[model samples]
Target: MSVKPQSASAPFAGPFALGTLAAADGPAFPALVDSEEQVLDLRTALDDPALTMRDLLERWPAVLPRLRALVADPGAVRRPLADFRVLAPVEPRQVFQSGANYRQHVIDLHVAHRAPDDERPEEERRAEAAEIMDRRAAEDLPYVFIGLPSAITGPYDDVTLPAWAKKPDWELELAVVIGRPAYQVSAEEALEYVAGYTIANDLTDRATVFRRDMPQIGTDWLRSKNAPGFTPLGPWIVPTESVTDTGDLRLTLKLNGEVMQDESTKDMIFDVARMVSYASQSTQLLPGDLVLTGSPAGNGMHWGRLLRDGDVMDASITGLGAQRTRCLAEES
Candidate 1:
């Protein structure tokens, strides 16, 4: 299955991006993908068969120059990208997910999801939500949560909607990949630790988001968002230098050919640097760790539409490439 090449307005800023790919006869290996959708086998180009994406990221400062040289004059024979199966670009040791970080998204949820007894005017509810969001952005830190790395799946893989997940939904987001150790970093210096950017669809089981049995404890992120294949990540990692503005990229997610979520990174209450800096305050973020900025407005819940079997999600972020994931019902 050959993959399609990026159009004239390619999302990647650099001539090439790093990815993980596997041929039918071989194990997964690090690769370099060009705009034409041709892949250079990095394992062979670097002459280190054991090298992984994590290894490159850990030594990014050193590896970057070498990668650039290879792209300039790739003497090695390149293969069609479709010849190999694309996998998640990196295997993160830790995943930090920001929640309610997008301004309009929060407002949309606030207006759409109301108490059954409440009968406020639509405009009134919207105005009140907007005011609350403004205050939260000014006074509160980003709301972040931990996600299991085990939930990650390939960009084009099939996601099994668990039988118990009655209200499955899609949340396409911009993911920040860490290049260096970051602890107690300030927002001003946070971008220096970034390795690159990727796309992640943080699928959720809305029905299980809130723990009814224990309202005091609140959200059950593990059960609601960490199911296997819940996080469909990456066709490749676009270097941070490739992105001109981390705070101004477009994020769009389409379900079964219908546009559902369409918004820009500018709508985010907490930008990439702020989100990473906030996460670093408590945890020592290592190389390859992923910090997912919150998804923008237009989730399934907002449209009163939920995921069903055989639904396909095409999610993309500006210049970071796209992911195509198919939804399947868990077998009985």
Candidate 2:
């Protein structure tokens, strides 16, 4: 799909910085920028703004650095984005996620797959995720999974489950938006290339994620995430430049204001810098490709839980906006 353009004439009403944008005036993505928030819509903001994504890095070198400063200052973009209706910050060319980058998550997932009839030592269970851990010793390789580009949705959007879904669980994760084309990049140079960060809930249905019955079709991980409104995101992408410490950001998941998951990204064993450099070896990341850094330890499946109709879930990251959604039953 072709990327859209931003209207030159006040795309939004309130204070806004250079990169921030409002929705396309109607039933577009909701307004992320209001009198009280700092937001940007990479899709809308990049729209023919006299500069392209590639242009910002070279021809208009000052612009990229300005964006970094604005996001960090929060208050800097106020005048340009005060009234803009916020939209998803980026229009990714590809979307991916790490499988066991965080130690706690590795532990939780192994526990979930435990056999009811047989017993294995916890060390044995962790070995599965461990065998490949060393691959990341040099970079983000060895522990990631490809997510369907179509599976991703804008932040603040609703998540719809398949009618046959018996389990809908949330995996709280932090996602990174790539800023440019990259291949064989070094970890030392990774952070400089990231556009920003956002909160993501990798919704899944384990019963269908890896089913053998679907031989006529294919592995069902896509089906698990491809349900309409499945991936809830938004608030907005906090430009990576603004975040000096991606390692320590706090993440939380709540249902009706009650905390369900609370942890810090600092626990990530692989971290963002390595993931980007490693992913670049094979996939060329273009502007807007999202890399969902793995989730932390707390998830519903750990407790035999799942989302039911009318359940409102909200996920928040330290600097990113909170995403809210209500799970609804699939249509009969």
Candidate 3:
């Protein structure tokens, strides 16, 4: 991923002084690049001896000062953001994805939304549904699951099919990128430590997802959810400051420009604030960590379908931007 030379005049425009390119002018990044055309390898850039996450945050008051100077010259050092291959914004030691955290997601669960009548008493059904609703409320415990970090891929990367899988699905979700170490933080204090948010597609295999062919109650969720390139994020991280309200934002998914799934962040079962707080209750969330906030309704499998080869899926949020990925057939 070679860097492109910065231009004299700004290439894109928006807030945060993009220098030659601004936020609005670029593609909406779920992992880091807005689109393949404007991809950037931020990981390689950070790996440079001159920069580190610590330096970007606190060690140096001005992490981009040197880079800023470099960009200003345009002719010196490497190229601009338009030149590199986009990469996942975070390299987390572990990834966690919330399940059925949105109201519509619950409705989409269909039969799984509840147990058989004989298994659950009337009281139990009501209580369970109440509990589920509480969690989905903007003000309750946010359920989360550990996701396979290796499943992550860049914005424009391809989503591959898994062997023995009858169905493959795409879930458009709003992902939280952790900025710093946080432990047992309160909901009110959670957003302060957030680095930003990006669109994430929580791709899954249908068979393993429901443990349909498995013998045991617990299926290999990691294997089902963490296929290669299962997670597609970026096109750059939208700074937390730029978003006015994570809850009120509209989220939509399109297959080759046709809207497939569309909803608002306000429908989330657990809002970002509660999610951050609940996640930090036991473990420390480190910088460069990612939290996939679950998907809304309208997944492929819900309609007895799956993503086929050459299918292009693009997910977008109101202010955060968009991430597009092409679905490809698995090589035997």
220-276: candidate 3 lDDT, tens digit per residue: 677688887888865455667667788887778888777888888887877898888
| Model 3 residue 330 lDDT score | 76
- Tens-digit per-residue lDDT, 1-332, candidate 2: 11111221222222322232443463333123433444444334444434333334232334565444444564433334434444455555677777677776776665666789748777777776565454444454446667776666655555667787788888888888776678889989988778667777888887787766756765567667667666665546555545668889888888766788898988787889888887888878777688888888777776666888777787778766566767777778
Q: What digit string (tens of lDDT, one per residue) describes model 1 on residues 69-187?
A: 88888576798876878889999999999899889889988988889998999999999999999999889899999999999998888899999999999999999999999999999
How accurate locally is residue 28 in candidate 2, as Cα lDDT from 0 to 100? 38
Per-residue error for 159 in candidate 1, Å, reads: 0.7
Q: After superposition, how far is residue 10 of candidate 1 from its true place, in Å?
A: 7.4
- Kindly give the stretch of ten consecutive residues in candidate 3 with the minimal lDDT sum: 1-10
lDDT of each: 0.89, 0.64, 0.65
Q: lDDT value for candidate 1?
A: 0.89
Query: Candidate 3: lDDT over CA atoms?
Result: 0.65
Model 2 residue 241 lDDT score: 48
User: TM-score of each candidate?
Assistant: 0.94, 0.75, 0.75
List per-candidate RMSD values in Å.
2.3, 6.7, 6.8
Residue 198 shift from truth in candidate 2, angstroms: 1.2
Summing lDDT over every window of 10 consecutive residues in candidate 1, give the lowest-scoring window. Answer: 1-10
Say which candidate scores most in lDDT. 1
- Model 2 TM-score is 0.75
